[model samples]
Target: MSHRPKVIAGVALAALLAGCGEQAATAPSPAASAAAPTSSAAPSAPATPVAAPDLEADPETVATGLDVPWGLAFLPDGTALLAERDTARVLRVRPGARPEQVLTVPGVEARGEGGLLGLAVSPGYEQDRWVYAYYTAAQDNRIVRFRLDGGGAPEVIFDGIAKAGNHNGGRIAFGPDGMLYAGTGDAARTATSQDRDSPNGKILRLTPDGDPAPGNPVAGSPVYSLGHRNVQGLAWDARGRLFATEFGQNRLDEVNQIDPGANYGWPEVEGTGGGSDYKDPLVTWPTDQASPSGAAIVGDTMYVAGLRGERLWAVPLGGGAPRAHFTGEYGRLRTVEVAPDGALWLTTSNTDGRGDLREGDDRVLRFPAG
Candidate 1:
């Protein structure tokens, strides 16, 4: 569960089923929103199919020849800020210019999954010029804030979190509420995913200053939800519904609708199943098919980046479970983000030492959101 290179730890029974079980399962609690439908049964009636437009019949490459681009954040001016995992450098990409190394962060451990991972611009970027990043430090995975101006030093905001070489959860974004939300890996410890006291393997809600949000389930705790493995992606729909993509252990990879105080089965459960206390995944994929990474929501569709699956998946977001749209075209897609132009930009990760790289390995490509 811990993204780092470590061994799995034992699970704590109380935390494992905390607020999840028969009593909570029957009731429609706020936490129930995190459950995903796993049934193979067909719907009673087929809804009118909405045709998806061809965003990119031939997807064109935007940037190329990178070490391993892990995270991407778009500026208001249409340029992009990219994080290269192994290099610990942040590159700026503009429409008609070459990529430029704007900043090189120090103290980043470039082991397995421990490096510069996710990036996000502040909601008040015009005034603050703040950029947030998730990376592995010598002690643990931490979140830091930095000014966009070159040579500005990073100020540590959150620290003392569990870190693994592989499952380090590293996605960070600003919610509509102006609060910062972070998705963390389990740190190779299964019980940590369910521990409210532990920041590992959980979705955290915090203020811009990295303080725990006021309305969290537990006072003074930033944990939004628990029992997650390696949560790589987070997105919000037009209706403000939060969704996340998590890497599975061996059987099922998952996409879940996240709700405050929700508990997702990790060491106890993997895919969808009937449970009174815990929430199920809205969608499940074989681990090989969907090592899902970053996600972006557009209109009624959720576009997810597939790492091992090597494809872009379009999950219909009309309120039910997600179904795969397309599979196996691009190789090792790592990040999927909605650009300011309304197009979806996907970054490839084949060069990240995980998969086989092709002719244009480690590139950023753009596609229309059909």
Candidate 2:
């Protein structure tokens, strides 16, 4: 894909605002210290596999025979849309039926951890029949919108996001305010995470037309917050608190309560430290147990997907820090989304060139939360 001039413009803008001081740094609580390692060589025990919780027992497979399925979104009428990263295909799946390819998008740069990654149904999907996606094009990772016409071409709504092979964050969701929100990565440039002017490492809030949403933290820009490395998952709880899952640099992975305009430390800090300006993560896990990807919130609990950790983490959340309930059940959990029937739908990433692949390497699993 050709490099769009807008991407360079965005980078220039980011460089101008990269001088902001780090903010809101608090020491990680003792609980957080116990969950995550303090240094790179900290001796930590391997995560033990636990029995499938009763709520997750009898998880019926929704789809099979897929290649690196990354994200899933359900239509208003109950059909599902899934994105296959390497294949560059968007599939429409009906219950108990074969998945049909809706469209094969072009301009995908399937390199390393980058590819077609996240998908979301438009907030007005019942009327518009539009689906939004985040993918790595040849030049950059971008978010685009398309109509879900089976076997037809997808109309590109927007393009020119920052892209990198490893930290190409690609999770998108429509927030409660009827606006689209995208989580972006820093494209291997750590300073970009702290650059408020850049869209690369921020939570972007935009209208359906891809314009900046009203009352954004940055006037005339879609950025809601700054200082993020690679945010891959976004979800809202019943209480309307937004949460995001982040990939840590080396030692710590995090789940944070996303506050608008907040600064989350990236290059300056890893797990937790004291600086008084950067916001500390509410929960941190060792990178080995929680290279988290996607997340879903049901009731007071948050279900997070782990890529390298090879587990599905159940975190109970209310106000204080989140607590881990279960770890290491399904290997390499990739995506977790709330289903219409109230069950949490999850996908695996073992076949995504990251880990060992067993029989039924990549399949969708459902866990009904009681």
Best by TM-score: 1
Tens-digit lDDT track of model 2 for 88-188: 99998765887889888777889988898899998788888778888998777877777866435555555666787788889999877778888988899
Q: Quote model 1's TM-score.
A: 0.85
lDDT of 1 by residue, 288-338 (tens): 877999998877677788888877777765544455544666678899888
**Model 2: which ten-residue window has the lowest total lDDT?**
39-48
Clashing pairs in 2: 23-277, 23-278, 24-276, 24-277, 24-278, 25-276, 25-277, 25-278, 310-332
Instruction: Tell me how many clashing residue pairs each candidate has.
Output: 20, 9
Best candidate, lDDT-wise? 1
- Against the reference, the lDDT scores of all candidates come to 0.76, 0.72
